[model samples]
Target: MPHRIAAIQKLTATEPHPERVAMFAIAGDSASGKTTLTKGLVEAIGTHRISSFCTDDYHRYDRKERKNLPFTPLNPECNYLEIMEQHLQLLILGQPILKPKYHHADGTLGRPELFIPSEIVIVEGLFPLWSKLSRATFDVTAYLDPPETVRRAWKIARDTTKRGYTTEQVLSDLEQREPESEKYIRPQRAHADLVISFAPVEGRSSLSATILLRPTVPQPDLHDILTPATRDAAHIKLIRDQDGKPVDALHIHGHAPEAASRLVEEKLWEKIGLGGDIPASLGRISSTERSAPLAIAQLIILHHMIHC
Candidate 1:
């Protein structure tokens, strides 16, 4: 077992599953920026310290077989939920699992890959938080809910460019998956400790992210971190969430001057150093260039994972 998981077990000895591994669940719809966000966290924490998995791998049928099925892949019936739950339990107990691999490129099932438990196991996919049993396995949960228009654009770009789908085919597939997404996907948002939404700001072409820090988990003190950054320039705020409950709503401007984001980064690093040093490859998005707001978001998640 990884040292961090062992240390956590020693620290939480009295709790159930005292030897449980630290796990994070990132749930979202198709192309909802799950992989983009997960990549940053892995980089910040050091890839060697984290073992990642996707619940989509539990799909019972290959892509071609799914074409004849009545239910979509998003439906629970289409996945090996029982096996996933069993494997998750094993992972929490510091055991290894012979995991199945689904090749996205050719729509074929590859050989089972043996994955041993690590200090942190990141589970990201369409249904990581879909069940109560699966939900209990995570130490932290996040849901990505980008605007529909923005998500569609992202999905089209990804599917056409990487997944070998034409633009029209991708759009048609999305239309067919809408009902499943609404039924089995979006509802997972309520179970998240954080709901992240990235979209273009009004009157500005640059994209910005609004992170809703829910009360379900402990959050960093951005107020203390933003100390001298002045409210006018720094967009961070602690306000009521949509449910009328008090929550910290952090807004990171995409095109904001470097000094503005740097101020926040400095304070964040001051409070919690980036695993000793800032990672050189952190915060990369879909494009080659990195976004300051995305980097800050990654830092926020890394801080919580270490300090929570």
Candidate 2:
């Protein structure tokens, strides 16, 4: 929470720009839907207006090198934290950075590439809000806090299918990473303006989403959209957070009728005042599948990007 004070102080010390680039941070453990959530926002905002990249690229060791290391990639010591912070500051100032690349498929360090910031910048990965200075760079920040069982399943699925790991290997790596995840990764949730959790509803195939809207930043007023008529699809209520603070919690049911979810989406899109149809790219889980809860979550975040 000290970082929040630092963030406020830093913002007040700097001269505001009329065309200042808005920056968002999505922090979470490995395969906790950070990229998926960021992908939707980029598509909705347009690639020309937003630039996004993973902070995992700052890892100090490659896959081969990590085998002998004592700490996992989730540890702050395992990444170039200072460099990542510097690059983030530069990006917020509308400057370019020669960003490092980490190849997720093979776990190798790739060539450094030039990264230019656009009207909006989304930095997603494990350590975007790890430090006070780093936390000060974002206009909005969110943390994905999926259930451990669900996250483990997602990690296993992604690693086996795309990263060429066997089911057993992925499980083993997850067990090893759990301690670091608890120590370094989960703590960042405290720094986020929004904390998102996506979990399977009982007897449902798709995942329902729960978002905690913290008072750290201005959030969209959803009282008009979350009426009893839309309760089957989405609703909002005051709840006590982990820290015992009262916060607004928004729940989007995955099993809700398509029409019901669409109505909520329409209301949110109108609130965004973008003056166009909702982006077709919202809610896409894959080329073939989409989740209404995911779509609604993305729209709420998009609302923050435009209105907040």
Candidate 3:
């Protein structure tokens, strides 16, 4: 029993922080919308004020080497997790570090880049919350828990177009990586203060989002953001989570009418207490398309990073 307790403490040991920088973690499996969710927050907070990096950069093996290794990149053994923990501690204390760069376009490691800590730092990748010590570095943590069907579709599209993989190759790789994802990635959700899930709306082709706001962390009161009727009718809801715990489940319908989405956006901006100069382009994932749900989700996260 004493030996087991020592092992647990070693896994969760954290250094006392001297400075508090707002750190946020976005953890999810491959093609789980981790980057998509983070893009909007980067824009909303302004890139100059935010220091963001992908934790996958800590990968111990490049693409070629990973193929020969028994364990996939999702496993902690395949990553420099101890180094990552050290860097996270340094960043929280307002210190800079030399960060390794991984070039995804060609599956190669680039030269290390100097990273200076900013007012806010956002770290996103598969294993940001894999260890308790690393998870302790973040002021806020979110896990993307999209439905598997949706996630598979996103993976196929993203890998084929961006990563130069064929549909068949991506599918096969996903199959091989599933066990690792279940073992390391999904378990991190329990450490998150928020879980963002995007699923296809029934009878609709577009995807909507449901954000699970855990009571473990302080959340902005979106319920009273608008008037009584508007608040009640708004897309957000306060419901009990699956475990019979009271949680706020913010639903942003993809097929919502223009007027309704606009109303919600305006109310969110009001809740932000920011001036009218807030740009509409903050949440756009692509050049031509924008998701109100994505924007609102970014707003909710930004509120925590900025105010808290």
Candidate 4:
């Protein structure tokens, strides 16, 4: 009996622990499509297996309070970075935390709530990858790099419609935050494993997506999926990164034929080995509108979430 008990303990020790969790960080400047991308991922992966929140909730000041401060919220000084780091560490260990909340609509801080970590955790916002300590908590990280014009337009639309900001106020705030954005926000892109950009394809209202895959982490092998026959829908090529390093850039044409894009999506879904139809929510831009490029991007990220 004693020998059998010892053998059981040894076997259990080698088995995968149920409490192991994977954390992902999606960091970008304001209105750079961070939340939208995160939303699609959460939906695709199922919220039961995912817990997501915005790091913006750690803001040290409300909008009214920031009026007296020299720096905008984009500055690290305006957020509770230390506390955020602590919470991230806790979540990585499958622990729960009482997280603070900041309401964007009224620019007010709300009561803290208990947040339990799931199998996967996605933290998105301005400073998820701000420091080495914070970046170390995530298994994977992605940064949104939409063009300035596109991001500006998105900010104006979202702020005016949802955040109670006028176009003039939004524009002025963007101008004021530019310096901080340049200093604090853009620099985080260098630390991300994937850099994603969505821009308008000429003559097409939809936006094309370009994803730069860095070798910091292992990415899916797309050679078999993106072939000459499907080149119009998506393709990959070697490109020089900002630091002059060679990286693989995957481009998904927003204007490609639906069938062609769907074939690529199907192949990617097969690689995930989830064994079901793709989630109806994969590329949703709105309740009624969907973008193929957005869907493809989300699938690629989903693959990393499960396999990384």
Each prediction's Cα lDDT score? Answer: 0.81, 0.91, 0.82, 0.94
Kindly list the per-residue Cα lDDT of model 3 for residues 1-308, writing each as its tens digit.
99999998787566454455799999998998888778777776677788689998998888888888998888899989899999999898888899988888878888999998888999999888988899889999999999999899999999899988899999999999999998888999888899998887889876688898898888888756545444422456779876687877887777776667667777767777767755655568788888877776777787778777
lDDT of 2 by residue, 272-292 (tens): 998889898899888898988
Q: Give, for candidate 2, the lowest lDDT window spanning 10 residues.
A: 12-21
In the range 186-222, model 4's lDDT, one tens digit per residue, is 9999999999999998888889999999999999999
Query: Largest lDDT belongs to which candidate?
Result: 4
Model 3: pairs clashing at backbone N, Cα or C within 3 Å: none
Regions of candidate 3 where Cα sits further than 4 Å from its true position: 1-20, 226-233, 236-244
Task: Give the C-alpha lDDT of model 1.
Answer: 0.81
Candidates 3 and 4 compared by lDDT, better number = 4
RMSD to truth, every model? 5.7, 5.5, 5.9, 5.4
Better of 1 and 2 by lDDT: 2
Stretches of candidate 1 off by over 4 Å are 1-20, 228-234, 238-244, 274-276
State every prediction's TM-score relative to the real structure: 0.89, 0.93, 0.89, 0.94
> Sorted on lDDT, highest at the top, how do the candidates line up?
4, 2, 3, 1
Better of 1 and 4 by lDDT: 4
Sort every candidate by TM-score, greatest first.
4, 2, 3, 1
Q: Best by TM-score, which number?
A: 4
Q: Give the TM-score of candidate 3.
A: 0.89
